[model samples]
Target: MKHCLVVDDSRVIRKVACRILGDLRFETDEAEDGAAALEICRRQMPDLILLDWNLPTMNGIEFLRALRREHEGKSPVVVFCTTENDVAHITEALGAGASEYIMKPFDREIIESKLAEVGML
Candidate 1:
């Protein structure tokens, strides 16, 4: 099974993503912030990351940049899960090394479809 790291400050959101990923056959882990997520990346790199844009210590873009730089060309496929629907925000995430982007208020269908689009299913 594929491993997925879910990064979100909100516990509810993290749980939601984890459940969605679980339903899709992913072994999911949760991170409350970028710091924890980064540590987890260094320890065991997940196949995919579902990250939120708003975090306490480091935001999603910062986390993505850090992961991208540290892992070089072998980083996990990162998907930004954010409430920011602005195109510029999405572009920034992509530029920072996110593989895909999804807006917040997501249901299982959306998350499942997004993962499928990335071939995680």
Candidate 2:
């Protein structure tokens, strides 16, 4: 199964994403902040990343930038799942190496479609 890392500061969001990814047959892991997520990546880079924008220690953009700078970072498909819905935010995320973007208040259907679009499903 493909491994997925859900990075969000909200415990609820992380739990929800993990559960959805799990149901989709992905091996799931989660981190409450970007720093923690980066640590996890250092140990094991996941096949996909479901990321949130605002986070403690390190924000999503910073994490994406840092992750892309790593040796194996470009291998993982980064998908920004966040409340930041501005065109600029989306542009920045995509420019920073995110493969896709999802707005907040997402459900299983949305997640499924987005994953499929990124060819992760």
Candidate 3:
């Protein structure tokens, strides 16, 4: 089974995403912050990462940059699941090596669609 990491400060969000990913046939892991997520990635990279924008210890963008630098181009596909809907934020995230973007308050369909866009679903 494919592995997916769900990084979010909100427990509810993590649980929801994990459930959705599980239904999509992915084995899921949860991290409450970017630092923890990075540590998990360092140990074993997941096939995909559903990341949140706001996090403690390290933010999503910072973690993305660090992950990209540390893993080169072999890093797992990262999809930013954030509330930031501005064009600039989206462009910044995409330019920072994110595979895709998913706006906040997402549901199963939206998550599935994003994953499919990234060829994960």
Candidate 4:
């Protein structure tokens, strides 16, 4: 099974993501924020990542950049899950190396499609 690390500050979002990923046959792990996510990344390299932009510490961009720097393209592919709907935000996240980006209030279909695009589903 593919392993996914979901990094989000909201408990509800994290639970929702975990449930969805589990339902899809993906092993799931949780991180309350970017800082915690970084620690988890160092310990276990997941196959995919569901990242959030507005985190308590470090934020998604920093975490993504850090992953690129440290893991050097071997890091798990990341998808930014966020509320930022601005085009600039999307562009920035993509430039930072996110495999995909999902806006908040999304469901299984959206995530499934994105994952499929990256050949994770």
Maximum-TM-score candidate = 3
Higher TM-score: candidate 1 or 2? 2
Per-residue lDDT for 1-121 in model 2, tens only?
9999999989899998999999999999999889999999999989999999999999999999999988544579999999999999999999899999999989999999999999997
- How do these models rank on lDDT, best leading? 2, 3, 4, 1
- After TM-score superposition, the amount by which residue 111's alpha carbon in candidate 2 deviates from its true location, in angstroms, is 0.3
Q: What is the C-alpha lDDT of each candidate?
A: 0.88, 0.93, 0.92, 0.90
Those runs of model 4 whose alpha carbons end farther than 4 Å from true positions after fitting are none
Q: Over the stretch 2-96, how does candidate 4's per-residue lDDT look in tens digits?
A: 99999999999999999999999999999987788889989988999999999886898999998888887645889999999899999999898
Most accurate candidate by lDDT? 2
The TM-score ranking, best first, is 3, 2, 4, 1
Decoy 2 TM-score against native: 0.97
Off by over 4 Å in 3: none
Instruction: State the local distance difference test value for candidate 2.
Output: 0.93
For each candidate, C-alpha RMSD in Å? 1.0, 1.1, 0.8, 0.9
TM-score of each: 0.95, 0.97, 0.97, 0.96
Worst 10 residues of 1 by lDDT: 68-77
Residue pair clashes in candidate 1? none
TM-score of 4: 0.96
